[model samples]
Structure formats: structure tokens, C-alpha cells
Target: MLSNRQLLVLQVIIDEFIHTAQPIGSRAISKKDEVSFSSATIRNEMADLEEMGFIEKTHSSSGRVPSEKGYRFYVDHLLSPFRLSNTDVDIISDAFAKGMIEFEQVVQKSAKVLSDLTNYTSIILGPEVFDTKLKQLQIISLSNQTAVAILVTNTGHVEHRSFSVPANIQSSDLEKLVNILNDRLVGVPIVQLHEKLSDELTHLLHKYTSDFDAAYHYLKGALFDQQSVQLYVGGKTNILMQPEFKDVEKIRSLYSIIEQEEEMAELLRSNKDGMNIMIGHENKIDAMQDCSLITATYSLGDQQMGTIALLGPTRMEYSRVISLVNMLSKQLTNTFHSWY
Candidate 1:
């Protein structure tokens, strides 16, 4: 319901605050070439905007700062479509130009590219397990009582877990179990591994070893127990550079949340396709109240494979970051599609 002048004034305040991270005064808005209003007229608009909850006055200064509501309105209405700088496009293109044959390599590199380009922490959720097929499963025994289970996907991603060998299962039993799983479970989608093991392989495993029950138990504990999605994080320390994160307790909480891979993966997966933005208190997570998160998905054909996200203070460079994320996501989709 804001008039054209009020909208312009709000946009000016937000843009200025984003750039300088300082409360903006009406005199400053008047000084801008895009603003034709005089200082007195602009001050009147600021007062109305503050009354409407779009802007707030800081205790320390007469100047105003954009409230969370102000940021939301700016993103939803005043944001102009932005084109990625040539340097940004080239950086992304060059990063992907190298031959990256594995999914891990591509995802890890993408994470780094985003963090480096934006100077913000970047997170990427690897392709969901349901979409990936098993390429190999191997068990390497460290001792008679302990061993490690390795799961390899067709995309060249590897996961390993250590477990105590069941008392009834010998090294020979482990070998036989691995052979049977490789024969029957290779090429099976990861999401179906448990079902395939129960319905299809139980009898086959019994046929190969007398310790079939122990082997089945071991397999469940070692391999299927791992998380269904993998999280890749770049520039974990980059958030420290933002002025808003100077509070030690806030940084500690944010870092703790970031380290929880399962929680973060779930959060990223919940995002709908295309680009979405959450600013300040709009984010559900308590620790992210002072930040903004921009997320986009990369896909193979129609199926979404993973997510790309950037995290920074709410005073983020929205236009530039939005453009960068959109371009990077498209590049990722093309790269993945080319691989398939």
C-alpha cells in the first residue's frame, strides 16, 4: 500500500544500509542522485515508514535502519534483476572447466566456488541416496574383532564406517558376505538396499555361510546405518568476517548448528525448487535470526540432485548474491546433466 515516493525512500534506505551497514539519515537519502525528494520530505517518508514497521530508529542515532519487515518488502518488490559480473561468470566457468569425474569433486568444488566468490559460508547437500546406485561394497578387517565397511556409489562418492565384528562372524564369513552383497546388491538404488537385503538376499546369504544371521546383523549396523545424504561445507570460518557475527555466543551457536550435518541437510532439502530467500527472523532456526540464506537446487533433467546455498548477515548484497546463486545453479544443472 506504500506510495511511489515511500517505496523509493525505503529502497534507498535499504540499499544504503546494505552497502555501509550504518543507519541512514534523511539527508543521506536526499544526497542520492536517484532521490529527488528534499531532506524534509524524505524525513516525513522515513517517519511514516517507521510507523508502518518497515524501518526503525536506533537508540544511538537519529538515522534509521531497515527492519526485518523492510528487508522482506525490499526483496519482494524493489529488487531489480541483476546480471552477474563477467568476472563472476568466468570464475564459475573456469572452476567447472576442469575435468571433474566424481560427484564429490563437483560438489566440493561448487561449495568452494560459492564461498570464495561471495565471501560467505556455502553449503551443498549431495544428491539424495535414493537417486544414487551402489557401485561397490567392501569390508576391510583391521583385526579379528574390528573392521571397516566401505560403500561406493556410481558417482564415485565413498562412505566408510567402522564397527566391531560380530563374535560369530569370522574373517572368512566377512569375505563370503561381501561377495554375496556385491553380486546381488550392486547396482541397487541405495534407498532400496535394506529391502533388497531382507527379501532378496537373506536366503542367498544363508546359502553361502552358516553365520548368515550374524552377517546380516553386521551389514545393517555397519553400512545401512549411515546417513542417507551427505553435507559439504565450504568457508566455515567465513561467517566470522561479518560484523554481525562478532558476538562470541552467537558465533558458537551458529557454528554448532553448522556442524550438525543431518540437521542442515534436512533444512536444505526442505527448500522448494528454484531460488528461495530467508532473511533474518524469517528463518526458522533461532541461530540464523541475524542472517540471510539464499538457496537454489541443481537438477539432472527433471529430478533435483542437490542444493546450493549461501549464508551471510541480513545486510547481504542481495542483488549480486541472487544473481550469482541463480547462475551457479544453472551451471551445476548443466554440468550434472552433461555427465549423465
Candidate 2:
């Protein structure tokens, strides 16, 4: 447990480091209006805090910076309530006020706005398809030998793939296949689509068409072969603006990890509902060990739909970012709820 004076000193050091990204000295804390101690007295408290492993001095500087443990303590105990400014509220409100109705459009705009607000990379994982039921399926013919299969979810997300039509499969077979799929698969959750097709729909397809095997294989390849998660990353270049990521090799490594959508999506999905804060080494990814990840879940009705996250250096503006993430998550949830 920290004494009141030590806590105040630690808080000041972290707040200063967050904004300036520089080590803080006791003299700086003494000069603050809320601080009533002399530099000498503040220095004593800082020494005690450092001895307790709350702060450390860089090799090049005598000034102290918060350690990862210090940051965790600050977030858990010392953070003050951060109220959003009118401008901040307006920025978020105006985004949703754009009258957009589609889930992808709303989420895309939210991701871009979040990145612009924090000047950090924002990654949003679209709702998992497992809970989304099929709204429609269409096979549009592009030519005599090629066609596109489009899948539409209840959330208005569309996935389409083009494949070569087998010579043995006629256009009439395609029509019958789509009609049967729509009739049987509509309203079925996407996660169950494959099993449902294998058990129930396959026999029906064979009864309707002589070339069932060829048509079934083609349709499966087009629709279910790769059901990758939908990931939207905004302001990918914003990491370049952070001083901590100035090293070319570090930036490259981090960018490479972010580009792997599966890894990032899985990382975000690991968080439970509500807000989660992972500081520095708490992050499991090697490239993110020097960073902090703040994640919040947005929901549709009672179920969680997706995650909104901000990635920044460990010297992140935690209070402000937490407030922003919380507000945005609620906004996203409310928007989705309005649709239902």
C-alpha cells in the first residue's frame, strides 16, 4: 500500500509521462498547483515510490518514469473520472448522426473516427457470423461457364465469391440449388450452416439433380471454403506518429502482426464483455509488448457483436482513452439495438 503522498507523486509522474512521453522529475511534481510540497519533500516520496518498484530511471536520465507495474496501479487505483469535452461528444454524436443504416458502414465510420480522435490505430472486429442468420443466397450468372455466389446475413453483411461453373451443371441446376438452399437454410445461424447442409440439404440436392456431387462441391467451395473473420483496421499509419515506434524495424514488426487479421481478431475476441486494459507485457503478442491495448465490447440485443480497440504505447493517455472507448462502445450498442 502506498501512502497518500506517494500515490499523488506516482499519479503526477504517470500523467506527465503520458502527455510528454518523458521521464518526470520531483521538481516538476512540486510545481503543480495541486502539489503543496517542496521539491525536496517530493523527491523523498519519489525515492520511496521508486524503491517500491513504482518508478524507474532511464539510463540516460535522472528523471523517473512509471514502470509497467506503476501504470497498472495507476489505472486500477489512481485514475480520475474523465469527462468528455463538448467537442469530443460532438465528434462521436455526429458520426452516428450520418443516418447510416448498414452495420459495415457504421462500424467502418466508428473505426476511422476512433483512430482520428486518438491518433492511434483502431481495429474493429465485425460481429461473429456464428450468431447471424442467413437472410438470402443468390447465384448470379456471369457467363455460360462462370457464376458468382453471394451470401447475405441478417446484419446486412454480404460475402460473395466467383467460381467456374462445371460443364455438367446447367443453369437450371443452379436455379434449383439456390431455391432449395434459400428455402431450407434461410433463418439458420451461419455457424450451423455447414452441418445443416451436410445432414439435411445434401440428400435433397441429390434427389433434385443428377450432377449433385459436382454442384455441391462448387457451391461449398464458393461459400464455406474460407469463412474468415471480418476485420476493419483504421489509421494503420498512425503508429508512425508515435515516438516509441520510431524505429523502422519495430514498426515493421508491429505492422506485420497487425496485418495478420486472424491473429488480431483472435486477440480481440479473447476479451470478455465490458472494458479490458492490457498494459505492456500483459499483451501476449511479442510486437505488442511495448504497447497497451484497450478493448471494449459492443453488443446486439443481449449478445456481444464485436470489439472496439485502441493500440498505443504503454505511456498511453489511459483516462481519456478509457472514457472514449466506453462511450463509443455504448454508442455502437445503442445503434445496433435501434436496428432491432
Candidate 3:
């Protein structure tokens, strides 16, 4: 356990380091308005804190930086409630005031706004379309041999694929197929569409069309082949501006991981509901070992819709980012719930 003075000293050091991304000295803590101690007394507290594994002296200087354990303690015990500035509130309000109609549009805008506000890389995992019930599906003919298959979910998310129509299939058969699909799969969740099609809808297709097997194979491949969740990333280059990421190799490794959308989507999805913080090595991804990940989940009623995350150096503005994420998540939930 830390004394009250020790906790205050640690918080001040971490807060300063977070802002400047530079090591902090006891003299600096003494200069803060809230700190009442002399430099000598603050130095003694700093030494004690470092001995307890909360802070470390950088090799090149006498100034101290918060270690991973220090950051953890600060997040868990020392963080004060952050009040949102009017600018922050205005930015978020303006984004939602644009009359966006789709969930993807709202989430995409949120990601961009978050990145712009904090200058940190922002990632949003869009709601799992599989869990959403199919609202409608249509196949529109662009030409004699080309057509587009469009799928819309109850949440107003749209997915479409354009493919060449098989020569053996007739236009009338396509209409019949769509009618049968709407009748049978209207309320079915998208995740089960494949199994439901194979197990139950195949026989119905065979009864309506002469080229049942070939057409079934083609339609399935065209519509349900790629069902993975979508990941939206913004300000990927913003991480380049952080002083800690000056190393070229570090940037390269981080970029490679971000490029793997599937991996990132899985990582975001694995976080539990509400706010979560992973500092430095606490994050499982090797490339993220030098960074902190702050994630907050947005929901529709009781069901979680997606995650909004900010990634930056371990010396992140945790209080402000946490407040922003929490507010944004609530706004997202309210917007989504209004739809239902």
C-alpha cells in the first residue's frame, strides 16, 4: 500500500509524462499547484515509489518515468473523474447531427472523430452482421450476364456483391429464388444463413428451378462466402507522430498488425463489455507491447453492438481518453437503441 503523499507524487509524475512523453523530475512535481511538498521531500517520495516498482529512472537522465506497473496502479487507483470540455462535446455532437441513417456511417464517423480529437489511432469493430436478422435480399440484373446481390440487415447495414450470372439460369428463375428466400429466411440471423440454406432451403430451390444444384452453389458462393466482421480504422498514421514510436522498426511492426483486419477485429471482440485498459506488455500482441489500448463497448439495449478503441503510446492521456470513450460509447448505444 502507498501513503497518500506517495500516491499523489506518483499521479503527478505519470500525468506529466503522459503529456510531455518525457521523463519527470521531483522538482517539476513540487512546482505543480496541487503539490505542497518541497523538492527534497518530493524526491524522497519519488525514490520510495521507484523502489516499490511504480517508477524508473531512464538510463540517459536522472528524471523518472512511470513503469508499466506504475501505469496500472495509476489507472486502477489514482485516476480522477474527467470532465469533458465543451470542444470535445461539440465535436461528438456535430458528427451525429449530420443526419446519418446507417449504423456503419455513425461508427465510421465516430472512428474519425476520435482519431482527430486525441491524435491517436482509433479502431471501431462494426456490429456482427451475423447476429442481425436479414431484413431483405435482392438480385438486380445489370446486364444479361451480370448481376448484383444485395443484402440488408435489420440494423440498416448493407452488403452487396456483383457477379456474373450463370448462362444456365433464367431471369424468371432468379425472381422465384428471391421470393422463396424472402419467405423462408426473412427473420433468420445472417450467421445461420449458410447452414439454413443447405439444410432447409435446398429442397425448395430444387422444386422451383430446373438448375437447382448449380444455381444453389453459385448463389451461396456469391452471397455468403465472406461473413467475417468488419473493422474500421482511422488515423493509422497518427501513431507515427508519437515520440515513442520514432523507431522505424516499431512503426513497421505496428502497421503490419493493423493491416490484418481479421486479427484486430478478433482482438477488439475479445474484450469484455464496458471500459478496458491494457498497458504496454499487458497487451498480448507483441507489436502492441509498447502501447496502451483503451476499449469501450457500445450496445443496443442489452446486446453489445461493437467496440470503440483508442491506441497510443503507454504514456497516454488516460483520464481524457477514458472519459471520451465512455461518452462516445453511451452516445452510440443511445443512437442504436433509438433505432429499435
**Best of the candidates, TM-score:** 2
Sorting all predicted structures by TM-score, with the top scorer first, yields 2, 1, 3
Which portions of model 2 show Cα errors greater than 4 Å? none
Q: Which ten residues in a row have the lowest lDDT in candidate 1?
A: 297-306
Please list the C-alpha lDDT of all candidates, in the order they appear. 0.88, 0.90, 0.91
Candidate 3, residue 261: the lDDT equals: 90
Per-residue CA lDDT of candidate 1, range 176-245, in tens?
Answer: 8889989988998888899899998888888888787788888887877666667889999999988778
lDDT of 2: 0.90
TM-score of 3: 0.94
- Per-prediction TM-score to the true structure, in the order listed: 0.95, 0.96, 0.94
- On a 0 to 100 scale, what is the lDDT of residue 200 in model 3? 95
- Where does the lowest 10-residue lDDT sum fall in candidate 3? 297-306
Q: Over 4 Å off in model 1, which ranges?
A: 300-304
Q: Over the stretch 114-167, how does candidate 2's per-residue lDDT look in tens digits?
A: 999999999999887667888999999899999998888888788878889889
